[model samples]
Target: MIRVHIARQFDVRAADGRRLNAEELHAEGERLMQSLLDLEQCNDDFCDSVTATDADKGTVLVELLISDETETGAFEKSRTIVRTAIHAIGGATPWEASADLGADYRPRDVQLEYV
Candidate 1:
């Protein structure tokens, strides 16, 4: 099993292009985390479990326990699962993501920019 820790910073904005308040941002972060948990429940073959927490304002920390035979396979699957969870929470965008694959493995810094 490989443990993947992902940190994401979201600059959430409303439809009118205004930044979201602290309360709204917190709610959105909770929603995003719930989405990830739901995805893990559905895709048991790729992931063993998922947990998320609010690191700071506009930032979320997600830890995914992945069950893959190889390190490369785990990395690839983690990327796909994270992306799917983000997309599931429609309208949440313009965020940056980075991943840490334990102590021995070099951290993978993956960022997604949406317009």
Candidate 2:
């Protein structure tokens, strides 16, 4: 099994310059989770038991477990999948809008385990 920890940061705001409410943030997290789940279902090497958890500052941490039979470069493939999803939610260039790049919660601390 291969496991990876992925984190994505979200902003509490909409495109219209309005602050997002708690409900909206929660919805976004769920939306992201569903997107990941969708990806997992489409890949035979992906594990069925993926997990998503809401984190502080409108961020979500996802736990991805893949089967050992997956091909090489699995890490890069998984990273791209998540980065693309985050960019999609953030309008392709969310970091450009914020002076502090960290505000966008770019994915970080990718811990990989193979067993």
Task: Please give the RMSD to the true structure for each candidate, in Å.
Answer: 10.2, 5.4
lDDT scores in order: 0.50, 0.52
lDDT of 2: 0.52
Specify the poorest-scoring 10-residue window by lDDT in model 2: 99-108
Candidate 2 residues 62-107, lDDT tens each? 5565554343466666666665555555533343455422224344
Residues 18-82, model 1: lDDT tens digits: 55566766665676678777886778744433333333433344456666656667667766776
- TM-score (all chains, Cα) for each model: 0.56, 0.56
Flag regions of model 1 displaced more than 4 Å. 1-19, 46-57, 92-115
Residue 29 of model 2: what lDDT? Answer: 63
Residue 5 deviation, candidate 2, in Å?
Answer: 6.7
Residue 80, candidate 2: C-alpha displacement in angstroms: 1.4
Whole-model lDDT, model 1: 0.50
